[model samples]
Target: MSKCPRCFVSLTSDHFAWTQASGTTTEADPVASAYHGGQVLSRKIVELRRPVDAHAGWAPPPQHAELELGGPVREVCPTCHYVLVDGWRNAQVTCIAMAGARATGKTVYIAVLIKQLQLLGESWGAVVEPFDSTTEATYRDHYETPLYEARGILEATPAAHTGNPYQREPLIFSLGHWNNVSQILVIRDVAGEDLENPENARAPWLQFFAHADGVLFMFDPLKVESVTNQLHDLVPTQERVGGDPRTVLRTVLGIIGLGTPNLAIILSKFDALQSLQSVEGSDWSRIMSNPGAAFSRDFSLRSAPYHDGDGQLLNQEVRSLLKKLDATPMVMSVDQPHTGRPLPNRYFAVSALGESPVGDRLHASGITPFRCLDPVRWVLATRSVWHWQ
Candidate 1:
């Protein structure tokens, strides 16, 4: 069974529901309000009966006769009321939830990650495109435009309850059809402020984390006072910094509960740390300058499949780096999670912008993403979408 992109609930034919597109209005929908933050148009949900034995074939049950004479019916998620995209039920979706504290570069990473996915898809003989119009428009206006066209830092993602919260809708990308199955990638970006505040932890929308295929939890190394102090002279000061990452990580794990999502603890804004190479006589300088370090070079752009040897090397290297950055508690939490469930995890480092931003503007050198695709590739590889060849 496929899952709803928005709510991550399994989509089974037995509990199918839909609405007539013609009657959808601006009136509030109770189900949508619960998850979307407000009253959306009320979609008349038509729950269909489960089909009987074999030879009944693909036709809907007789009770829901309107479906047979469908004029403009739209299939929606039975739980969240989100309209399912065309062929969504048949597609293979890889759902990922983005987590991080404020200014951890989640938005920036998403912007760069999509572009990288497109390039990667080309190499794999696939054409990646938005699965729906909403995803297409949202990606262009909120993500692609601000970073690529305007050349400015994206504004912080608004919380789910905020009016006009663009992220309430998942960014669904279709990675063409592979092996007779349509491969889809669904990404949901969470607001850092919401995650930091314990008050928002019980929100219904957050339940998706428990069901997600993977979670990319980013932490900005520059947020550490020690790291910031070291880079004070080398890089421009950031306009906004987020809360302590440990606090946010705790909140994320709490939300996950017993769900077994593969966690990728990503070190964001790595370019800032990479610049430590310029600091003479410092251990960091020596570490950053090491040509053989997995974190020092990006092999993502290569045509070859993801290399487990390099990934394992980088994972261990980053685990050690996190320890040195005083993220021992965060590391400990993942290593021995309090959630009472086995959490499969990997450590990754990425520089979405490749260079630190100057004020709200991007670096004049342009966006040169480094290792941004590693986490996604890791998730895909685990799902058998790709492999280390």
Candidate 2:
């Protein structure tokens, strides 16, 4: 049995109970349940104990229960009640959740990121593909179509009942195998509006962030006044929008509490910064055009498989960049908080769109993602899957 990527619940056969009906016969079996009870557990606390009659070294799950299935039974996550199928656990799963204010380029990132990952996975002898039917349909209809095929900016995600909330489901991917073990990646994208409104998070559904392996907190560079002003001539500037990053970050921290997960504070829509190179005489131009700078170069082409040092170097560069953007206070909020506790965090920059939207159309340069894989790579690196080059 393996753990659910979202809530870290031990996903064993026993926790699941389901029912199936064939003709006039109805069968039931154990499927899954919500993560109830207040008892907190670590990876070792709930060990899989096998039945006495089972094979040697096999262990039975403690939360084992039976399901009275009215139809075909399926496995599911005990934490979020998300269902899963066989062979889902035979991998090093990494779960990431996205948080930001609305129009932070998350939907575009998802569509383009998938294509980029597919390109990168080829070099590692891995094929990146959607894990389930839901992901395939959703990714194609909602995310992939408008962005990739139609070449337009994705519309704002509708509210839940509005029927077009782009994030109604998690994006699950199978990244082939890594070092004899399969690598499964699950990403949960939340509406920026949801994260912006902390008062609404009292519900139990929002609690999953507390257990995520990593949370991508997108800080839209376009939201920064100075940057927007400087780039107004080079790119189209829309009305100042999005809730304060500080507010959203604090809410995310509050939801997760003290759980140890990588917090990636990302400077999103970085391609606009890249365009600042045209400013010619300005300091921003020099910084933006510096070929040797971490942000200027795409390290994804490096021959080393996974170099922690390379990623850390980029982190330092981005930290300074964020300071330049006047996000220092937000950094402090993550480091030395007024609450006296800080999350294990890192700073990153990614340009999912690679350029600002020209009205409803994407810039002709096409989507060139920068450091987009950094956050996900860091989380997986923590599991010791690809720690060293």
Q: Using Cα atoms with residue i matched to residue i, what is each candidate's TM-score against the true structure?
A: 0.93, 0.84
| Model 1 error, position 250 (Å) | 1.3
Clashes of 2: 20
| Candidate 1 clashes between residue pairs 3 or more apart in a chain or in different chains | none
Worst 10 residues of 1 by lDDT: 60-69
Candidate maximizing TM-score: 1
TM-score of 2: 0.84
lDDT by residue (tens digit), candidate 1, 1-389:
47899888778766777777675354667887777665677646666656575354565655462564265677888888888766789888889999999989998899899999899888978888988899899999999999999998899998777877898889999888766788888999988988898766677778888888899999898888888888999999997888889888888988888888899999999999999999998899988899989998898867577777898999999999999999998999998888566589999999999999898899999999999999998888787664543
- Alpha-carbon local distance difference test for all models: 0.85, 0.70
Candidate 1, after superposition: displacement of residue 53 in Å? Answer: 9.9
Q: Model 2 segments beyond 4 Å from truth?
A: 5-72, 301-303, 386-389
